[model samples]
Target: MPQPPIVHTHRKPLVYALVWASLPAATLAQEAQPTVLDAIQVSAERGEPASESTSSYTAASSRTALKLALSHRETPQSVSVITRKQMDDFAQTDVNDVLEGTTGVTVESVETDRTYYTSRGFNIDNFQYDGVGLPAVYDNVQGDLDTAFYDRVEVLRGANGLMTGIGNPSATVNFIRKRPTVANRASVAVTGGSYDNRRIVGDVSGAVTASGKVRGRVVAGYQNRDSYLDRYNNEKQMFYGVVEADLTATTVLTLGHASQTSDTDSPLWGALPLFYSDGSPTHYQRSTSTSADWSYWDNVQHNSFAELSQQLGGGWQAKGSVLRLEKDSDSELFYQYGTPDRQTGEGLFAYPSQYELNTEQWVADAYATGPFSLVGRIHELVLGATWSRSETVDESRYGQGIGTALPPLEEWTGSYPKPTFDNGISGSDWTDKQTSTYAAVRWTLADPLTAITGVRLTWLDSEGVSYGLSKATRYNAVETPYAGLIYDLSHNHSVYASYTEIFKPQTEVDRDRNRLDPIDGVNYEVGLKSDYRAGRLKSTVAVFHTEQDNLAEAAGTFDNSVDSYYRGVDGLTSEGIELELAGEVSDRVQLFAGYTYVDIDTANGHTAKPSIPAHLAQLRATWRVPGTTGLALGSQVRWQSAIRQNQGTVSGGPNDGQPIVTRQSSYAVLDVMARYDFARNWRAQLNVNNVTDEKYIESLKKFGTSAQGFYGAPTNANVTVSWTY
Candidate 1:
């Protein structure tokens, strides 16, 4: 990413117009004095780009947690930034893949194409494009965004209601896009891997005007690959283009567009059954898949955005941005689940389903920041406003009759005949709208102590019409406040304490068939942040506690003639501690390591959330050979404690008399990478994942007796060759 300098000024349009009007005369004068023009060009080229940073793996500053740029030591919340170098070394291709290696974050796949991310015992439902927040909906189409067009991904842990108007208390993820650069640059790469995988990518960027004030960039990529599973294959295509212009010395303008499409054939709808009809656990091969040959899932996304930034006098700046996003998806899937007889596989069943959805969203935000004098002390202040709206239309259909019987397990193949179905019924049409005004101030209370306080006034409205239901919900004039205090223990160490709030509207119904009120919560955290080796290395140790009320849970029982309902729980609490270290440890060594422990419980203990491990740790290190130039090797290790799901009791089956307390034993995975600059302008690299080929379950259903668990990927490797010009 490359950005123009931040400008703070008034009368931006007038200033730019005057500058453009004088360009001809300035050019003529410069032509007459070549020496003066050369000096000016050199000075201009020396100016640093706003988006490019000198840090190798650590970020110097971020604006995701708060709308103001702050360093890691200054921010009160835990933040993780994955830079371009890390993504390339880890071979991360998509948003989900990147988060999988991120600290304190967990990724789970419900199906082949549907993925979910969680942090600190809650689901992460807040996402941003640049600095603008977007609606977070848990649809299959929203989680497969590609990372080719992004420069980096930033994750802020814990509650962030000050910036994101309505969201869960987990965390917020921000994707920063790449921008045009002032200098000419181009690169191309080709990759080949196991399962017949192949991919190619090209990028080009340069100035379009002789004055070097106007620049443009374009990136394109294509990939096609076969999976380890039978009959499963995927193809992806992506494109991105951006144009930037220096309207004036103090003003910059940017416009960009991006698009991605994924086409997957023979996609799996669900995992295979875990138990046999005789109450015995069954074992399946790592490559076993429950998909039919006719299954397919296809999705397409398009995004367009514009931004304007102006430098105001006296350390002040103003910036504004608008973004529009549209996504469409169509999927046809076949699922296999049900107990199978030990010998005949008599009870095996198949389910076929299809769905289509179209979603569109628009977001706009503007902010101004500058220094102000209060009580003879200069303080930093920021004020901003944001508006967002989203709408989704979906249609779906499922097989009407009873499940179709499948062949014996030993004789089953993936070439089942495609089933014919009727036209799908209209599913749901919904719209969400939100608006907010926010302000924050960095108060200089003393020489070594500073306080940050912020507040947001929000208005939200949601309306929807479903197959057999219609409803409207509104939260008007809600207020969320934030407060934090930081004390410098030393030049390289800081201790901070912060408090934040959370507000999320739930659609769950009560025993009377009425929707429950919104859930409210508060988060408290105390942490120590440190920077070493001139900010090249960063580390944090934090402890956090969160409590929520009015949590919706299942009611004891429901009347046969009426729909089931939920009841609000009085108390729900989650406590956790996290430790992380990331960045270059030495000139030849780069390292990243993290550890987390979390405990969550409900007042009644009967409705506790599951699938969250009690402990998790991750470590990765890369070393460049001291004697061999352009040669580097890296290794990574990830481990998690056991995860248990309390399924309560089985209903009516071979294991009816037993309790379904399913547990997945602890697991660990290893990965290795090597890169060598074999030539002047060319390089080759290899990445091997799951080095030991560990086999384990990645996700398990509450009722483990059912067939609803996902398996981890087996060992695989890829080789890539890249060229730069």
Candidate 2:
């Protein structure tokens, strides 16, 4: 349950750094006034340049690792920033779209309303808002999280044990919210795209008081879209509002709320079969739908938060925040199983059910950061504590006629009768409480070398009933440590190494019905980073290794046991290398590019998690038209290596017991964009994605003869018009 230090860097800086290299010569020559000094200080402390108005593809600095603002060249691990400009240029409306374009990350859209993300051969379960952590929803994201309310998204690509509870070695995602601006600003955008997709968004921010000490901001958006799949449609609405007040010269207060709702019709519970009864692959039209007409999935989420900050003088500050989040899910789903006959189009059966889930979480955090003189040199330190509690309840109802055979596939129209849910609810209720205290220090070991060391102590307790089974456990003083060293080779380059640890509690039971112990892991990373054009452009080459112990491996059920069990595993390792370059490339060009390679193996030398691609590459670039005003063009390409999974043969058939392997070959997708400004405050843009109309599967696990395999989206285009003031 170890969590990150809750340092509130969103406030004004406690100190200032004066660097003349990156600044314009004219501005740098005459900027010693107190007001100008404050502006410069704020730029250094805000973690990163606010991406809302910046048209750059990269940021100057970020603090996702230890809450200490550091430039990209100083961080010891890999990090990526998805800016608002990039999102707008590419029409990235949701979290899934943003992550799919990021380097070294994969978005696994396994179903219509659910998604999972992976990096470095592990699942990403750590998510944060600003600096506060949010508990994941059972290891997956279940709703459509829009990006209209965020200023930017920062992704740390390694074990961030110092700043998260689970210490997952995969990655951590931090969403920075758009704050109220002192200057009045407003914008509105309308977009239309393929598949009957239409969207509109509005944003307003300005001073709410005569003295300009109080400011408020609001953002709202609505979207309706129909998919290429038959009978599938989705509608979503999102809202965000925030207010800020300066109570004193050195004290500030902020309050905010956010809500979103999503509704989908004919949402699929499972994918189409990949193989036929004769042991050959089955091909279906891209528009085919296996979901029943009555099936639907609906989700809603709400978040409320408040924070207070005060300046204590002497380059020190203190901050505290509280957040509460609630989520609800409802669904009626249809699933089809069994491989069909190639000639007869028979052998498929249906299973239908109704399900509901509700989850709520609360977190309170406070921290202090300041500068100290250590051995005649200035260093920084952060001390903080966090407390959080989460509760989840879920239930499912079995519908009548769950095992009815489907009609012939060639003529299927999803006209199966809706089933009646007469069975009682059957599900689980669970709760978790965690408390943690952490401290970290950045030591100025030398003029060109710095060391970062931190430790966290956590206490966790869980108690509740889960599916007719007892779920009671306690852990105390779970200590996790972090260490890193950064050596500056020059003003524009650095080399770094880091070590961190992470742990996760397990609920899987053994054959004897005993709960398995928590899984633990460690991560090691070394990299070289280069900065160009005064940090306007950056590059990184990193090599990383991760190891996990006590992993859970599935074990078949024993006598009288209806549920399958698992045993502890040891020595699971993943190693990888990553290369990335991002930021302004030239006077009239901007770019973001990356390549990743990863391999996972068990102790016995066999490959693990084969469904994940071993190679990934991406490039996105934009260029201003030569000798033209307010005109730009962009292009993007994403490619991944082949992936495969073995599903075993169909039962009671001629090929029974034979190996069934499903594979997806290497594929690449291309996208293009064009934008023009006809007026000072008005502009229009167009984007075309998957220009090649590549046909490929989105994911491979749980995809075989019986069920579960989804196709990627086909060629699509969208146009947006916006006016700003």
Query: Best-fitting candidate, measured by TM-score?
Result: 2
lDDT of 1 by residue, 1-725 (tens): 22212222133342243223222232333444333211111111212223333436777788887766788898988998888778777788888778877888877666777766778877777888787867466422342567878777888998888788764668888888877877898999899999999999898988999988999999999999998877889899999999999999888999999999998998767776666555555677767788888889898988999999888866777889999988888998787766667667667777777878888999999988766554445567778889989897887776543277888655667777776656335577988788998877777788789888777768877788654445367777676677788999999999999887777776667666566877887889999999999988999999999898887665533542212467787689888899999998999888888898888788776436667887889888889988997999998888988876654555565667676555678999999999999999899999999999988887763322232565788999999999988
Error of 2 at 498 (Å): 0.5
Error of 1 at 300 (Å): 0.7
Residue pairs with colliding backbones in model 1 are: 7-310, 7-311, 7-312, 8-311, 8-312, 9-311, 9-312
Residue 414, model 1: lDDT of 79
Where model 2 places Cα greater than 4 Å from the true spot, the runs are: 1-48, 509-514, 553-567, 650-652, 703-707
lDDT of 2 by residue, 223-260 (tens): 99999888899999999999999899788899999999
Q: Against the true structure, candidate 2 has what lDDT?
A: 0.82
Query: How close is every model to the real structure, measured as TM-score?
Result: 0.89, 0.91
Residue pairs that clash (backbone atoms under 3 angstroms), model 2: 4-163
